[model samples]
Target: MASRTAPFSPFEFLIAWRYLRARRAEGGVSVMTWISLIGITLGVAALIATLAVRAGFRAEFVDTILGSNAHVTVYSAPMEVVEGSGVYSSLMRDYQVRAERVAAIPGVTRAAPLIRGQVMATKDGRSNVAEVYGISAADLQTIPRVANPETALGSIEQFGEGIAIGSGLARELGVGLGDKLKLISPEGAKTAFGTSPRVSAYTVTYIFTAGRWDIDRTRIYMPFAEAQSYFNREAGADEIEVMVEDPEHLEPLAVPLMRAGGDGTLLWSWQDSSSSFLRALDIEDNVMFVILSILVLIAAMNITSGLIMLVKNKGRDIGILRTMGLTEGSVMRVFFLCGAFTGVIGTIAGVTLGCLFAIYIDQVMSFVNWLNGGGVWDPSIRGIYELPAKLQGADVAKAVILSLGLSFVVTIFPARRAARLNPVEALRYE
Candidate 1:
């Protein structure tokens, strides 16, 4: 027997094409084909969109952490009381020297001594608790988020002269740049009888957003000297905030960083601070991926339905083709090609749409916000100002695999049914 024409040969493709393009009078599979194509397209596109959003959310979250907060915070131990002097003694007293030592270590980018405390901020009788970060004017400019002059309202030049406040806090207190706000501290002047709450008014010299909801809502940056006096840490800083060049790969420098901070100091990394949040994000991501995959599978079921209908309608034609010397394998290949073609085109279109959506997400959000007449995305609600989307190659590949895999799998049953149909029985009615 002349070797059966290799499966998926030119004639097989021609036959598949003709069947897919069947006219209305001949039992049109064309309508079903389009439905399957559209279903797959939407499914793949939705999968890509979900992946992009999750990637963007994680990226922005990490950015907020690194940009607005320190990678590692070093604390000086054994705060001892200096008798008669009425002051506490600690290794933090030599903060500048320790900061210099930490900064000198390899991979260490910045190390700044800062006094941190919580105080109540009041303006026109409205009061809110705020976290205060006391650092020098020079060190304030080192913060990445507030370093931008355009985004930072007022001036860093006068940071030390007064106090810098978060925009959220400012809004809550109804205070603007140059407005006077009073700060109340429980740790206050120790009188002969007892200590009294310290209250003082300060002008707002600068305002910043920090790209984080909680931070922007409660953070206040004061001068190092001012914070020291206010918090009664006049001898030294509370902790040394360190920024490394590669926070993600800090294992190599951990020993060095530890040695740099020297004895009597503790190291706290960012991972320690946000471990719970990160874990939740990872769990949510995995759950969302599985859920979206089910959606893709559901969409692919449409392909199976369409192909089965096509097979039933083309039963007579299949019988004629089988009698015309076409092998069962050739018949199966033809139907398989029809389904695969629909799947491949749908996947391509979906990928293109997904990438474009991710690339222009900012514009899309802007348009949506405009349509909604504003307040669509509140920073307070979402935790970030902008809606982010990041298109990743791996995510796209996964979507493609899911769509094609499901389509191919579902097509197999119908293709096999068509191949096994007996010509005699199929043409008995005819």
Candidate 2:
């Protein structure tokens, strides 16, 4: 009959761990070992910190794109006939149908019509190029998530010559709300000898800050009727903007959205519009990950080399253990566990240090700014002044997996060498 006893505790594993630590100290670390350890710690910390920053940037910009731009944009290549007297009102029925169909599409939230044009904006002897957006304020509310609703133009019923300007544009023109700004249509313009372009002024009723330099520095928002009047087209808007339920599936949905646009219209996804920029960002992220991973890999090599040296020093002990009936597998397991133990310790320390630094990066930056004078952390100059750290569980998981996998790979060589030791040869020296 077996005697009742407590199960073998995992705490017993610490004995082997302590032995490894003692042996590491007994031999006295060379300068190279110290450098290697430092290199590993710094490398792991850098990878974690960088991944956090990139993820934060991606999240912030995705929100900006969805907030300021449409989930999808539809363009009419040439004029298409609709129901009303002209296309604007006559096409209302078809427009409604298309919008409903878009909404029914998987992952789509809402769809609305939008008209855009390039026009010259002038105020107080200051004139700049600007792009104008014409939208129905009521329908806009339905898809407010696509663009920051706080920045939407005032009531559509009040479309009468009212306009909204971006914060950057507002700064450039030195204008305020209720102040009037002129919009000169390109078609209406004429050279001194030719007919001058049609020029009109509208009151600035709203100001928006979207943090996108391109949009904030060059966009104007107005009522659809006002844009129609300025263009003298009296026709429908130029395109439609769609809001999606899941932005990640945008690439897959582009085909259907394009089909819905019909022959004359061109359907463009955000990915299509910004493919080059997004690709560049992808390349940059990959490069950074690869470069930093090399440092971690080098640190792993240090652990491997250190373990190899230990095995050589302990050959006599290994031989004795073998003669004492310890299986070769157990012998390998002991060293494998020891090396894994070191990796776990190093990993825990690295992660703790990295997260702490990331969480306080903004405060650190602010302190540095203060020390340097008083303006080193300005957003106007740096683009984003706030130190943002988003600790994603996925990133942490990846880092741990990578560190452990590397540690395991590096341990294999020393483990195999230790397993091959001959008792007679090892005992000869002793």
Per-model C-alpha lDDT, please? 0.86, 0.69
Over 192-245, each residue of candidate 2 has an lDDT whose tens digit, in order, gives: 887668888888866777665566778887777766667654655667789887
Score every model by TM-score: 0.92, 0.79
* Candidate 2 Cα misplacement greater than 4 A, ranges: 1-15, 22-27, 30-37, 79-108, 142-161, 189-194, 251-263, 319-323, 357-361, 364-389, 427-430
> RMSD per prediction, one decimal?
2.6, 5.4
Candidate 1 TM-score to native: 0.92
| Per-residue accuracy of model 1 over 1-430 as CA lDDT, tens digit each | 2155876789888988887786867554677788888878888888898899889988998888888889999886665467566665553888888899999998888999999999999988899999999998888899888766226688889887799988889999999989999999999999998999999999999998888888888999999999999999987898998998988776787788778777777888898898898899899988988988898788777778878888898899999999888888988998888888889888898888888888898898899989999889888877888889988989999999988998899899999999999999999999
> Which candidate gets the maximum lDDT versus the true structure?
1
Badly placed stretches (over 4 Å) of model 1 are 1-4, 26-28, 82-91, 363-376
The 10-residue segment with the lowest total lDDT in model 2: 1-10
Q: Assess the local accuracy of residue 32 in candidate 2 as a C-alpha lDDT between 0 and 100.
A: 34
